[model samples]
Target: MPTYAIGDIQGCELELQRLLERLKFDPAADRLWFTGDLVNRGPGSLGVLRLVHSLDACAIVVLGNHDLHLLALAAGNERHARKSTLDEVLSAPDRDELLHWLRHRPLLHHDAAKGYTLIHAGLAPQWTLGVAQTLARELEETLRGAHWQDFLLAMYGDQPERWRPDLTGIERLRFITNALTRLRYCTTDGALALKEKRPLASAPKGLVPWFQCPGRKSRDARIIFGHWSALGYWDQDNVWGIDSGCLWGGNLTAVRVRKSKPIEPVHLPCEGYLTPGESGD
Candidate 1:
């Protein structure tokens, strides 16, 4: 079976549909992997959610920051930001069902046989693949458990900039969530520089892309991630960054992933949704 790992959809359902058509996606014979950010800041988040939710059997999704934000809003822990395009989803008749499904999605997915690890954003330099998986589950259990609301309420923060085994409680969980869903740059010593969002060439001298941090523990694992539209469609050093700025009128990308062959990326152009120079996830 062919497997396609797609970048952030961000609610651009029409583009998603066209891209799937371009690939001639056959649900019975092919698999789809989403890099997350499947909703928000686009015109069709409601439609996107329903469509992906309907394809549950054939689609694998890791939660993105936007996805988590939606859950927080639904749980009444956050107010919609000024550019929020999630009202449709929040008001949808099937909102509860959709949110439930999204909340249960994993933060990371690793296919040992295929040698691919998927996440919505970057991993901390301190975590090996095994360690990342274990940490993911710790937060996953909380999101899927009864106190999910409390977790969401406490989720927003930039503290605990580095990881330590001794870290416990909400601090630990927030770090995990930020590492897997918001990380972009970090110091050589593994302190997350969450504010750095510029492209590689323009990055400040001291910050290195998380994947390039010296002695990264997950260096040996092949990782696929999104949430860095500024970095766009990168492929190097055992990692793939495929966000491609779909929400900003760049392209929606999908890469055919194979165990022993060069992956092929397919791109579909998008009409600009939000104007340029606006802040977005």
Candidate 2:
């Protein structure tokens, strides 16, 4: 059985089909670990969300920032639609079911037997893989709990600028969302600079990409993430970035966990996105 860990699909559903065909993926034999943001940017947000929801047994997904935003917008946390990419998802006939599935997705997934951990973005500098997973569990449970709407309400900001386990309510949820999904740069003091999605040297005066930060807690674990399309295909010993910006006229990317260093990536042409908005990579 071949398990393929794919980067952010972000509403590019047909590419997923083509890539799977290239790999000869059998739903019964192969499993898929998605790094999240399965619906957004691209044109098939509704279809992708609906399909992933049905692939419950064969697919595992972590919640990406866009995914969280979709939940918040769906639950009426955001008054107006944030962007054009999400309008389709919000207005879909089965919006409720799609939002339910998205909100209930996990924050992180780790396969010990396979030696790879999957997150929508990358990990924080101060957290070990174990600690990251622990925090992820808290957020996942909170999202899945009855008061999930309350969490969604507080899930949109980046005010605190740090992490504290004692944080309750929406502040905690927001932090988790950023750290696990929207994260890109970090401060020298280990603060999250979620707004900047740019790469290392071009980042602000005092920021480094979280995965490259020295003394990073989750640095030891092999991470597979799909958020930074600009980061492209960084291949360090422990981190594998798979976002090739398929929605932005780039090719879809997928990496086999066990075969991280292998032949050319199976590329699929982009179906293009609905709009040319700011990329979440």
Candidate 3:
């Protein structure tokens, strides 16, 4: 029962299929974990959604910023859909069902038995595993509640850049959302630099990759995340980043997670869909 944690698909259904074939995946015995961004910015958003949604029993997904944007668009937030490639999904006959499933997907998943935690992006430097899980559930409940659309409408923003226990209302939720889905770099003090998406070598002064922040509370736990394709495949500092920029013609990557053995990563080259620098999450 091998579990594979895959990088951001970004709507690359064909690449996903090829990679699964390469892994010799047996859905009944193998579990697939996606770091999210399962849709948007590629040619096959609809197909990708259908395929993953069909494998609900064995597939685990955390929501990426792009995934949230897709939900927002479906909830009538059209202004942000200018560059979106989700029309096919929106118009599909099963659109509601797919979105419903997506809406219920988690923001974070932790398997204590496997000793691994999964998230779409970075966590606040101040969060321990328990804190991260609690915050995740807070937003998860809101997304699953009756007013989820209202939450979506108010979800866009970068304010309240730092996390605080006393934070309340939308401010608290937005911070939680950004930290879990949009975070990459931040000051050691935990102030998110969400606009800085470049690789580590080019990171601006005073900013460090969230996982690398000194004395990070979650540093002792193994975390798997994506949403930083610019950082490529990272495997250091108690974290693994597998988003290899598949949407930008880079390889789609996956790593086999084992309880006691070294993890192994596999990659499949992707045909260029959108060139680098056109846009990013």
Candidate 4:
């Protein structure tokens, strides 16, 4: 059974279909690992969500920032961002089902056999494969509860510029969500810098990519993630970034995780949105 790890869909539904066709994906014989951002920023958010939700095949999906934003907005905590492209989903008849399914999705997934860990963004430098899974559970439990909106409301911001084990209550939970979904560069001390989504070379002085932190303790494990569209389809054998930015007219990409050195991608071109004279369908 082959496993394909796909990048951020960002609501590019037609693009997703093209990608699967290119890969010759067989639902009955293969597995799909989605790096999340499955909705928003394209013309087909509702369609993409519906398709993935009904796959019935084995799939591992972690929550991306766009996915989380939809959850918070659905819960009436925040308005959709001006830059958001989620109107189709917001108006969908099955929006409730989609939102709930997303909330309960895992924050990180690990496969011992393949030595692959998948998250929306990437792991913190300090977390072991063990500690990352533990904290993911801590946040996941609250997300599955009534207090979820409260946690989402508190999930923004980049204060404290450092991580501390003593961080309690919503603060700690919020930190985990941000790190797993929105994180890019971090202070030398492991504090997340969620606002900067630029490429690695352009980061502010003293800040380091979360995966490249000094004395990186967890870099030993292979990780696959999608975020930071700036990073594009970069593959480092052990670290795979599949976020090729379909919403920005880049290709949709996926990688077979169990492969050996120099990972290669199964990629697809972006599909056009409905033009003024054409129907979206």
Kindly report which residue stretches of model 3 are placed more than 4 angstroms away from their true locations once superposed. none
Give the per-residue lDDT of model 2 (tens digit) for 73-137: 86668643556478877777887877777777888998898778889887778788898998899
**Candidate lDDT values, in order:** 0.92, 0.78, 0.93, 0.80
* Per-candidate clashes, comma-separated: 0, 0, 0, 0
Candidate 1 structure quality by residue, lDDT tens digits, 1-281: 99999999999999999999999999999999999999998889999999999997899999999999999888886654565789899988999999999999999999888899999999999899999999999999999999999999889888899999999999999999999999999997899999878899999988999999999999999999999998989999799999999889999999998999988999898886876568645
Clashing pairs in 3: none
lDDT of 3 at 118: 94
TM-score of each predicted structure versus truth: 0.98, 0.91, 0.98, 0.91
Ranking by TM-score: 3, 1, 4, 2
Put down candidate 3 lDDT per residue, 1-281, tens digits, no spaces. Answer: 99999999989999999999999999999999999999999899899999999997899999999999999998887767888999899999999999999999999999888899999999999899999999999999999999999989989888999889999999999999999999999987779898889888888999999998887899899999999998999899989999998989999999998878877999899886998889757
Worst 10 residues of 4 by lDDT: 272-281
Worst 10 residues of 1 by lDDT: 76-85
Task: Compose the digit string of candidate 4's lDDT tens values, residues 1-281.
Answer: 88899999988888998888988888888999999999876788889888888885578899998888888777775644665678778887887888888899999998898778999996777788789999999988999998898887767666645667898897788788878888778878776777777777788888877887776667788889998677888776357889887777677999987745455688787754423222110
TM-score of the candidate numbered 1?
0.98
Better of 1 and 4 by lDDT: 1
Ranking by lDDT: 3, 1, 4, 2
Worst 10 residues of 3 by lDDT: 74-83
